[model samples]
Target: MDILDILLSASFWAAAIRIASPLIFATLGELICERAGVLNLGIEGIMVAGAFSGWIAVWAGLPLWGGVAVAMLTGMAFGLLHATLSVPFGLSQHVVGIGLTLLATSLTFYTYRVVLPEVSSPPKIEAFQPYEIPLLADLPLIGPALFSQTPLTYAAFLLAAICAYTLYRTPVGLAVRAAGENPSAVAAQGLSVTAIRMGAVITGSGFMAVGGAFLTLSAFDSFFFDMVNGRGWICIALVVFGAWRPGKAVLGAILFAAFDALQIRLQQTAIGALVPYQLFLMLPYILSILALVVMSRRAEVPAALMVPFNKGER
Candidate 1:
């Protein structure tokens, strides 16, 4: 198809949203952690763990919801691990995060092989199907793109709103922000910075797990080692790319998903042959670098991000 044809297709937009679904969940989760002054790089492994945990739940004859619940619980466990290491013990966030990622990824793959063994084909599970919204599905272009989505897709959109409200409204939200900006001040005010950070990290992880679960449970069938690909890393970048705002993060995610969708569709066309498809695949990452450079100056990250707080120390 031609350029205009590609841009105008409702199917294309719908595909973009689908591609972005999981990323949004992960992004919001990370956003919460960062806003609370803790950077959880354990995100990649958490997602893999979630993907593995969710798949295992379904394999055991549990429903999709049950699998999701399992994934969230698994994610929370990891989050608590990160919190215990970084928040309570005052460990380096970078080391803890990277270490967790490696640990989680290794644990997942080893378990997968041990449980199922190497086979010609991996096990498959029933996945979620697209559910059309009755009234809006018929609208010319926008309706099909926005309204006609799986329940997960709609929930993702709703999540953006929920995140926006929680961070911008609510007393607990203020405490989280304060903990990020100035923990000593929060501590002086009788708010426990440790408690807020731990809560944010643990709760945020559940959302990240949900994102991973979406991959095996909805985006595609069966669990594959690399199914998560670099989506976790991309979610991390989008947090900065979105300037830590939910609406902006969603926008950044959609933009990345659009390019991702374009590259996939282009790879199938005659134009794809004229240029290397690998180059198109690089668009998202390339934009990530360029966007960070351009957006970094204006980006407002939490003041204490990646810094550990020791209650007894000044």
Candidate 2:
């Protein structure tokens, strides 16, 4: 039709990519942790924690990159806590993660009220600007539609590819995989399972933090109570959908995000009056359950996931 129609049509895909951005980052982060035989169910909490930390950092005059760095550090701290509980104290991984999530929820709310007690309106931070490559951004149809996205979107794509390569190609990746599969066997070969686990947890946290930072600093330009909005759980579901493969997880993230974007657009269209918004909101979870049901028979989960390892006991 006209230029307005073209923009509307293209906006659908663009919005999908935008929604996918955070999910991809968070899902890939969860994939890394899970692949290393650790089930950190705290992904959602860590994400919300990072969202607030990053937002506060930005509000305090730190550069946007600084905010991201602080968010990563916050995630790392939580990872350290998680590792301590599950790895050393022999606590239940699921329990520890649930506890962490609760702690994060409390922490985010406390900080929000304490810091902005009198502010009646929500506060915002400056979001990251899109950086478009001139010639490429000008290309026909797909080019501008894809290349004109926020920087975080490109970073998510690159990180997914890199994570795939790291998990399947490199020696370090091999060590991590081996540790997850058979810790005693790996340790007998002189590799430190604990060390590998620590590294994976930390790295995973960094990725998760970036996912949170992207939400406040790029997607929404502000932090609100529970701003992550269960995205962390969505990321965990994505890992199952992707079978813990980085590339597949990213694709799943895109699909989940597409449903989310579609729901938002539908809310604004004439069809909104005919359909229940709750059904649209529930689409991602429904897809996730369907994926789990279909893939359970075929998916290969890490053999030792969530099992605590003790050198002497082995």
Give the TM-score of each candidate. 0.96, 0.92
Give per-residue lDDT, candidate 1, residue 72: 90
Q: Which runs of model 1 end up more than 4 angstroms from their true locations? A: 118-120
lDDT of candidates 1 onward, in order: 0.89, 0.82
lDDT of 2 by residue, 1-314 (tens): 34345346756667778889988888888888888888888888889988888888999899988998899899898888887787767689899989988997788889888988888776777888877867887777656567888887888899999999999999888888877788888789888788888788778877887898789988888888867888898888889889888877887887777777767766666767798989878876787688777865677888878988887685
Model 1, position 276: C-alpha lDDT score: 88
True-structure lDDT of candidate 1 = 0.89
lDDT of 1 by residue, 186-224 (tens): 899988889999999998888898899899998986899
Best by lDDT: 1
lDDT of 2: 0.82
Worst 10 residues of 2 by lDDT: 1-10
Let me know the TM-score candidate 1 reaches against the reference structure.
Answer: 0.96
lDDT of 1 at 120: 84
